[model samples]
Target: MAKPQKRYVCQACGSVATRWQGQCADCGEWNTLVEEAGATVTPFQAKHNLQGGGRTFQLVGLDAEIALPERMGSGIAELDRALGGGFVEGSATLIGGDPGIGKSTLLLQAAARMALAGASVAYVSGEEAADQVRLRARRLGLGNAPVQLAAATSTRDILTTLGQGTPPALLVIDSIQTMHSDLIEGAPGTVSQVRASAQELIRFAKERGTAVVLVGHVTKDGSIAGPRVLEHMVDTVLSFEGERSHQYRILRAIKNRFGGTDEIGVFAMETSGLSEVANPSALFLTHRDEGMTGATVFPALEGTRPVLVEVQALVVRLASGATPRRAVVGWDSGRLAMILAVLEARCGLSFSTCEVYLNIAGGYRVQDPAADLAVASALVSALAERAVPADAIVFGEIALSGEVRPVAHAALRLKEAAKLGFARALAPVATAGEGGMTIDSFKTLGSLTDHLLMR
Candidate 1:
């Protein structure tokens, strides 16, 4: 009788080995070693496809294929811009966000737009029935776009349908978590199944010239919940981020093979559907009651687009020994901490006994250091309970030495501020020479201290 073959398997990473150990060196998981039948792909085996001889990695790029035509327009100007002009053929895109965060809504809009552009589109959803999707489509006011919908959960069935139908201009998978494959032995969302399903779909996208968008689920940490490979496998990855309580949603590109990764798309969820906020700054500041203390308008850039945003801050003295709390809703917490440290060390400002809360109005995340001036201004306003000028605009990076440091694209930021009817802008002194528009230059945080105190 043939002897049963045995091999060591690392449960953490699925790497196979002949020797066993207390820990899996392949994946660094402690005591994840178990003996099983050998299960691993040799480097030679992986270089080719499963069916036998296919294009090897080394065989590719012998002579790069001529670049394809320019991106196909998505019809929504803002989304087109966010996608760096449009969809690249055969690119796999993963869009992830919180539940009820407009993931399906956005894709439905895109599918209809593509269909209106005279391109065929197929939308697959496992969670929603076709009738429900069609009902939402009617609500979007999509005028006679020849878009098709399918309620499918099986990856194979979707692939088969795609193969049988006319090649679609785009394919929309409502989500990846719901997809299951018969080739994998695990549950739908298990690491193995997700990986296998994603790989198969990725292959399908690349083999066909369809722009496929996969909606994904986000974990509590705000990361897409799946094997890390799910992220690496896609050509582009975007996240739909916002508070569900608010109507505004921000689509940010985390990965883009054909475009800049820093691109962001702003939209508003209205009674109709997701509508692009063309002048997002105006929308972000529309609800302002005017002359409010602890409020600031800040000029910033997202990818190549410039925007002005309202920043609000609140500071209050603590009644107990809980220590000063600093929290930000739409900006980086680490960034706020860094600014606070700068304030304490450079300007000798002590809010150790106070509570500080910062918010970027409109549920938008601000990445521009230009907001430094706004944050500082807001901090002062909150502490003193004084209102910042309604027309005041602020942007600058603060150094530990209290110096206002220069930032990139001063011209763009200034142009945006000027276009927005902003009266005065406090920016870094160094970049004051770059932008043609008028702006106040401040070098030190201490210099602005009196201005805050006086206000």
Candidate 2:
């Protein structure tokens, strides 16, 4: 008899390997390899599923069948817009967040809205009892009586029950971490179990044409828990993020095949439910106190929305021998070090003696390189002991040559800034702003040194 196939997989990025190694060659993490029974399905398998022997030379440019009745409303207007107007039939959405970050609440709201919109919705809670979900639903003040809730952790029984239901219904599994399958012997949240469970869920959703919303948990490292393959298998992936002390939550898409990924939806938690924030720009603005150094506004774009957020910096004499500790909450730590190096070398600033710390308030994080200009300004302002002009917003990236590089959507950033009543903006020469404000362009940090240093 032929021997059964065996291979190893990386737990972080899901790259397969035939040999067991101490470190992953893909993601470069240590001890992440696990033995698997069979080889992973390649993208070629997907192509073969459609190609059928690769002999077709038929007509091209075929239009997609846009079905009207299959569309379902998510009840939240901004959320619906982020989903390309509404949920498409047979699409899968993976909602992820940290504990107590309102992942369950958001889905409960969605299920209630779908049922009220005339679509039969079934919400299966693997993490909570049916009574617990009912209590939370009542706390959210949901009065939509059409929705049904079931408590089940077994994936096989859950899929069987879904088969008995009528077609054209929405199914929600809250969440994937607590879900289990008899096919996998390990615990539910293990790397192997998660991969297997997610595969089954995806297959069920695809064959049944049921829109599946899977709630996912995030690891302590702040990434979605489970194999990375789970993310690539979904049709859309969203993050529900916010500071627990604050009542606001932001729903942002990290990946979407059907719609623009940059779109974001903001919500204000209330006694009733999640209320949409009509103006997110105003939410980030603070009540100004005079002469606060190291605080500057940088117009940043999230999806298409332009938000002017305050970039804060603190540079103080080091109290410990750890070499000027670097701490950042929402921005990249490596980028912070790069910006500091630019200040020390190109800008001729003295940062060796001081410890630098950067933070994005309200637990908000940004990955846009456009934040570079704001970070530079914040550091310079703190070093010079003068605040940046409150009316002026910053934009651009700091290069090793100290040049200011342009970022995309500069016009939108300035347009929102103008509507918010900002007057002067220090933007890169690469981007000239729209009307109603003066957009000054800079070539390098050396050119803007006088303005930032003297305030």
Candidate 3:
């Protein structure tokens, strides 16, 4: 039988090696190579000829008229919004998160809502038994939802059962890592196994016109576990993220062929299940009676949604010859260092002898570059021991040359801040005033520094 040729594969990059090695040559990752059996091919198949045998398919023009795929909501407004209105028929979505981060709970809740809304939904759990899922449903108050449930891990059996009768409108596989395909020569979650299993499931989803949601386990670095191609095979990639200590969970779309990326859906984990947070800005902002040093409000934009969050900082003088510490949470550490350097070089403010601490309120992470101005404001306020205006918000991009740059969606940010009762804004010079709020525009970091120190 040709004794099935053997080869080594890198789990990190899916690269093949002729022999096992301690480090992967392609990805440079250590101890990721594992041996696997290579498929034996006949002489004729090894020739790599593409001549004649496959069915011919017609190629259509880009402008050809075709009906758009229908979208069905899961009765969850936040989820629908993050999914670019709703889940498209025949689409495949991959969602990944840390363990205990509520990936299964969110999917089960969505499935229940869809079933209650009259959509045929089937949930297959490879990690848990059917009764365990049922118990969870009961806990979530969805015991009466008409969603079909099963506990299976064999891909062939799942396809066989799903192929019978009418195909369900929505299908959820509670983790793709646990699914095994008979055709694959390795255990489930292996590089080849994951690739092959996902391929079959995605093909079924497209052929059956069912929206399939696949749960994925994440690695220590917070990326989906499996070959990188698994993410590319799906129509959308969602990331469920939150700190275990925090009650808020963020559902972010990292890749979406049918929708905009970077869109986020906010949810609060309660005893009943996940509840949507329509006004996430309010939840992220900590209400305080008075403004304090090192605290600044920043209007951050998440996709099309504007969120107002507090930027807090602390600066303490370090002992002589002691290494200054720079700690940051919910904001980029490198960016904070760059901002501090700019403050010293451009604004003549020295932080070389100070230990700095920065944090974003409510365990929320900020990625927007417009947060530069706010973070700088907080740092300056901390060093100067002066509180920024209690009702004022700050946002803008700070360049290395200390130039205050304008950011996108300025109007949306201003309106949201105004709606949140922020009476004044310290922003870039180009930002337009809105919502009857007073504007304090700055043209450079030096000007902002002067305002903070001089005030």
Best by TM-score: 3
Ranking by TM-score: 3, 2, 1
How much is 347 displaced in model 1, in angstroms?
2.5
Please give, for residues 243-319, the per-residue lDDT of candidate 1 as tens digits: 88888888888898888888888899899999998888786774555657788888778888887778889888987
Model 3 scores worst on lDDT over the 10 consecutive residues at 40-49
Q: lDDT per prediction?
A: 0.82, 0.83, 0.94
lDDT of 3 at 319: 88
For all candidates, the clash counts are 2, 1, 0
lDDT tens readout by residue for model 2, 1-455: 23455799899999999899999998999999999898456666634676465676776565866655356788887687567667777888898887987778888888898887788888999988988999888888785457878999888888887888575468888989888889989998888887787788888878988888899999887789989999999998988888888888888888887888967888888877788888887777776566888888877888888877778889898755658777887899999988888888887897887988897755567888999989988888888888888888888887888999888888898898888888989988857657578877788987777667764
Model 2 residue 330 lDDT?
Answer: 81
* Residue 302 accuracy (lDDT) in model 1: 86
Best by lDDT: 3
Put down candidate 3 lDDT per residue, 193-300, tens digits, no spaces. Answer: 899989999999999999999999999999999999999999999999999889999999999999899999999999999999999999888865465799999999
What's the lDDT for residue 122 in model 2?
89
lDDT of 2 at 415: 93
The alpha-carbon deviation from the true structure for residue 233 of candidate 3, after best TM-score superposition, in angstroms, is 0.3
Any runs in candidate 1 off by more than 4 Å, and if so which? 1-65, 286-291, 318-324, 385-387, 433-436
